[model samples]
Target chain A: MATNRQIVLDNRPDGEATTSNFKLVTSETPALADGQVLVRHHYLSLDPYMRGRMNESKSYAASQALGEVMIGGTVGEVVESRSPKFKPGDQVVGMGGWQEYSVVDADAPGMLRKVDTTHVPLSYYLGAVGMPGVTAWYGLVKIINPKPGSTVVVSAASGAVGSTYAALAKARGCRVVGIAGGPEKCRYAVEELHFDACIDYRVHGDVKSMSKALKEACPDGIDGYFENVGGYILDAVLLRTNAFARIAVCGMIAGYDGAPLPLQNPTLILINRLTIEGFIVSEHVEVWPEALKELGTLVAQGKLKPRESVAQGLQAAPEAFLGLLKGKNFGKQLVKLI
Target chain B: MATNRQIVLDNRPDGEATTSNFKLVTSETPALADGQVLVRHHYLSLDPYMRGRMNESKSYAASQALGEVMIGGTVGEVVESRSPKFKPGDQVVGMGGWQEYSVVDADAPGMLRKVDTTHVPLSYYLGAVGMPGVTAWYGLVKIINPKPGSTVVVSAASGAVGSTYAALAKARGCRVVGIAGGPEKCRYAVEELHFDACIDYRVHGDVKSMSKALKEACPDGIDGYFENVGGYILDAVLLRTNAFARIAVCGMIAGYDGAPLPLQNPTLILINRLTIEGFIVSEHVEVWPEALKELGTLVAQGKLKPRESVAQGLQAAPEAFLGLLKGKNFGKQLVKLI
Candidate 1:
């Protein structure tokens, strides 16, 4: 039996999650069952949504139990297989969690999927060609339903989901505006992601100032918005949205700390005749095949280039995840577990 | 020439609208043109939406110009006509404003429509079988799309739109809950409208208490909401909404006075994966035929009995409208111009 290294949820956070909340443990891998495969993870995808799962409240997904492996997306290779379906050396993607190895049942529904890394990189499977990309497609293409020549705005625009959303909206002939935290990320959003303009939210101390900047960035007013960071950013966006605007609420990283962040003027939603929807990407698995195909093609053709903030080891995932919640990471925050 | 009694917008409102902002005037009726028809107004609809038109800012329709007849929905009879399309004694519905008479173009598109007063009463053209009815149908049927056995909630439950909405949701086999201002209105909603339960929002005091009451009223959790009164009521509803719940935002009368009423927990919108949409009924004119057919049949069969708070004359229009905004009126507030 081989040794497996895993990080488990030690405790729930009071306000902000710290390194003490997670504990590392090493254990012997159990013998393979009749239809089991052993997967050695190479990359662990850390996301802001994981913070929502740490608490005991009912989120979109199940809460992460104490003393259990922290849930995550992973791209890994099948090292051993008892089932004929999955053979050794086959690269796969699944909920492999924050661990070096996972014993998966090959016959289980939605357990794992084999990926072809020839066109797109293996790491991209955890990002632009994977869940985040699909999430952007679902929000932009399905929810927002952007019309050509319309103005579309996104928050946290340099992140994995935001970057893909901007690219997808830009492809549909929309004037894309990004709201990012710092100058570097804003510049990347505008220059690299091909957004028409990017507003650095850090420079604007308050929502009023940020709204002023957003008004300048989108002269025609925002017709659609992909919301990631809630709080003041959402308030500013609400003020600038045009009549009959649509907003897709993907994440509210600001409220994950458990403090209540109220909207100053919810009446704007009625005043502007807006449609705002909050959705979980996993719940919409029907669009995965179509979304992944387009995303994979975009990445392969260099039309959707995703930047990564790679943490060195599995031990760095907690810190990387914490940084992601604070908008410290420029793009997709990943842990190179290999 | 006959004299016309009209109410003009004397001045824009500073905060709350007053009778001083309106001026009653008598003028000689204009001579009929080649495509013209003279309409003798019978009933002038008084609604909360008129409050938005009182301000200089843009509303769903253009602002009512300060020294013109206050724009409103009216049911009337054509007394004279130059065109072959209309004749005397033909009861019609149009934007006839706050006046005893209006000279309208008979050939103009959407200017007038002859209503069947035999099946539905003339006053109902301004309430149950008209714009308010369509507004209710659009929000409840089109937007919320409630499922059978689901719990649907509505605010301003005793008012025109809200009453129709509660009835419609109930007819679809939904468990309907209503939030009304007083004990009388709440009892009326349950007994007259056949709502499963009704909450007297006045007694609840605050949003937290209201939310507690809501949780008790909707034991299975709220699946859909027809939002008429925003502010604390909206906050309370958000707290009790089930996952994937839908809300149709029709009106926010609480904010019409210009006081900022922030939502205390808007993040619940995201947490519960809710879809909230704001819509203007007229903007969706395509659904009018279907909506009106159903509404008219319901009225004729007495399944949708609409109550009225009729003010005496055109001089009573401003006071009636002001009262409507304050929830003083029992049901559809209307001014009998005859």
Candidate 2:
């Protein structure tokens, strides 16, 4: 029997998630079924959406039950295969939760991705080359459909999804401005990701002043807005949206721990003739092939680069998730189990 | 000089507008310039949007300046032409305001449209054949784009714009539901306008119950929402929108009378992947010719009928407008002036 270290949900927290909410324990893996493959986890992807799954609220997905292994995406090598589709030593990606080992059906919807890691790091498959990459692609191309020379603004600029959005919009000849929590991420966004400018929301006095700052930065007014943190930040951006602007509501990190009611700036949508849309990447899985192919090519050609903050071992998963929630992680927060 | 009886804005009201906000006075029309024409008002259209202009607050259009003639749309006859585009005895529709006679530049954007009253009543220009008709066309075809089997909900269903929207959506093969303040209008919307169902919001105890009633009416969930009375009705509709639903926001009568927020359904846009958009008919003039042609053909074929609530004389404009604001008018409110 192989020993598998798993991180379980200990308790649902009040406001922000803490280490006490998670517990780690080592257990023996159960016997795999006829079509199940035993995957040895190499990388775990920590995402903001996991915070939504922590609370017992009705959302896109059900909340994680207490004492159950916390769910997440991961990259792993097939150590043993009961199905002919996957062979021993073949590396793949799947929603394997936070564990050193997982037994999964080879043909599940979110089963796995075969990666040729010679060109890029295998972990990049969990970040820029994977979910976050597809998020930006589908949101910008399908939902927002930004025209050339359009002003696009992204919240949480240096994060995995924001970086992907900025690079993709820039490649399409759009003027992109990013908003981040601090100055360092702002600098990294402008200098590294090549965003036109980055606004430091932490230092900004208030939404009114920030609205003015955004108006000044986006002289043409915002044509496309990709919202990640959706509270007052959304309010500030809504005030500056141009006529017929399209807003893609990707995530609302600001309201993750709070009630989702009484949004401050809905009137701006009526006044400016704007279109506000909410979207989830998982809903468009059938059409995501084109987006993934494009992102994969961009990564192979070195045109798009994604940064990651890697936390090694299953014991570090809780801290990694907390860092992601606090916006401390520079880019994609990942836990390495190797 | 021609003597003109005009209704002027006497004062801005607190909650609901009343006759006290308007004063009737007789004035002489100014001498026409070289490029101007004199118009003799026949049918003055009293719309719900004018209520927004009565208050000294922000809207798409500037508020009525105190002690100034109330603004409105009217069907008039060109009594004298100083420009080649107009001739005497030509019946036309233009923005003649709330007055019996006025001077206008023949080349102005709101120039009169030639009338053909042989098949349909000329006042249809103010309701089904005019602004409301165009509003329905653009908001449905361009904004909402309801599918053949999609479910649609329209508030203020017996009013001009809402009635037109219900008829158009039903003709396009949609499951249409109308929401009105009274049982009489709701019955009219269902029996006369051919809406699939109708909901009387006034009888409902609260918005949550109203939302439940609306949801029961729309088993497939609302795919398109035409918002006329905003506030709580909008909030209820927002809570019930289906994925990828489209909302056409035309009016906010519920919030027009000093309500806190006009439309407060922000969460619906995100949770259901819905799109909410605001529009005005004036912005879509380029496509108005084709739209009007279709509406005219419908009326000429006797497939469409518009209801009119006629208030006699210029002195009745104030009471008629107040009745519209109070939701007392049965259908399209119009004041006879000729």
Candidate 3:
């Protein structure tokens, strides 16, 4: 048996989430049952989706229960195994939550996966080759379905999903543009991520200004868009869309707080003959294999690079998550548990 | 040569369209060139799309040029013909505009189609078996693509497109519900159009009230929707949409008058995983033959019934179109010139 330290949901958010809503707690990991594996999590991923679970309202996923370990993705090493599928030294990825250790039913299909880290690093399974990577793939390939030589844009362009999306679009012969919070991230998106251009949303905060920048960045007009931030950026993108443009909506982090995020002049949908679809990556598991293959290959070839903003220890998870929501995190946000 | 009375766009609307923006004038139908036919219009179809054309802004089609004959669909009889393909007294449907007569290039493919009215009324060609009917077909069959036993909803359910959609969905073995302006139109939708239930927006004008009504009407939740009117209706439907619901947006007449029709809670798109697509039926001419065949068969079988609110003479075009925009017309709004 081992003592496990974790963060739990203390209460639902009133409007916007704060660090006070989370509570750090201690528990003992019980002896493993048959078909169970004891995992020691080295890193816990902090994603934007966790914010939706904190709300009491009905959302795509079930609400996070109070006094429970906060739901999250984790990469770890198996310390002990009662399941035939795993061994003590196996490096694994699973939903290990906010706890330092997890007793997983490894035999429960898809509950845990053993990943090869000879060429790709272990933590990248949490960002570039995991859920975030597959998300960018589905929205770009299945939803946006851009043609070669077309222009495609992604919001939160320097973050996990957007960075991956920009790279994927560029690889597909598209003129990839990005929308990020500030100049530093914009520079990273264009310079490092190989985006044709990136617009700084902080300077062009409103729809009119953002539309002007988008017009300049996408001189041919935006043909497809992967939406992660959905307030003024969405309105601006809608205004600049070419005829028959498609939008794949992955997240609306701006609306995670209770304030209404209204789309100004939705009449543009008709004017532009647009198609806008929303999706959750978890629901579409069929494409994960194909997506992960592409992502893993790119990372191995040094074509797709990864960046992370990691907080130290489990207790820093809440602050790191809050920072992620506020655009303080530069890329994938995570908590180092070791 | 023949005297032809016509309505022309005199000016564009500043905020809301008014009758003063259109002018009535008389013209002489010029002598037909080779491969041309002169038609005497029986009925001119006044549709919501015309309101969009009156604006100077870029849209699916070009703006209705100032001092030119207002664009419209018409059912008429050939009065004179220089083309071998058409003869005098042949019934036809074409873009005859808001005039008593038109000189069309008969040899031009798709410009003029000779339609048989042996089992169908001549005026029905401008409605149930024409552009509006084909429009309803494409949105439901191609976009929404609902399954049997799924619940589909449509707004403006007593109008030309909505009524046809209600009939088509009912035929497809789906639970069909509708929303219209008043109790009378709602009654017509449910009783005459065979809708399972109908909501009256006059009573449920706001999002909260409309949402409650939709919950009761669509107990299984809305699986698909044909969005003709946008505003509170769009907001209410978004709240009640089932996961993976599809919305085929044909028009947003409520926003046509230059007022901002902001979509409240666009975040619901992500929450519900909805797909909303906008289209102009004229753009997809490829589907017309298949759509028209099905619509024609249903109408001839007495399964599809058509209702109209037609104004008399070319002079009434402006007033009738304005009335159609205000939900004053019960069904298909048309101007009868004969």
TM-scores, each model vs. reference: 0.99, 0.90, 0.98
Clashing pairs in 1: none
Alpha-carbon interface RMSD for all candidates, in angstroms? 1.5, 2.5, 0.9
Which lDDT values do the candidates have, in the order given?
0.91, 0.84, 0.93
Question: Which residues of candidate 1, in runs, are more than 4 Å off?
Answer: none
On the 0 to 100 scale, the lDDT of residue B50 in model 3 is: 91
DockQ of every predicted complex: 0.76, 0.47, 0.82
Q: Which CAPRI quality tier does the interface of model 3 achieve?
A: high
lDDT of 3 by residue, A174-257 (tens): 999999988899999888999999999989988899999999999999999999988989999999999999999999999998
Give candidate 1's total backbone clashes.
0
Q: Point out the worst 10-residue segment of candidate 2 chain A by lDDT.
A: A261-270
Error of 3 at B32 (Å): 1.5
Q: Sort by TM-score, best first.
A: 1, 3, 2
In Å, residue A93's CA in model 3 sits off its true spot by 1.1
lDDT (Cα, 0-100) at B142 in candidate 1: 95
lDDT of 1 by residue, B48-160 (tens): 88888888875645687899998899999999999899989899999999999999998888889999988898999899888999999999999999999999999989989
| Candidate 1: CAPRI quality band | medium
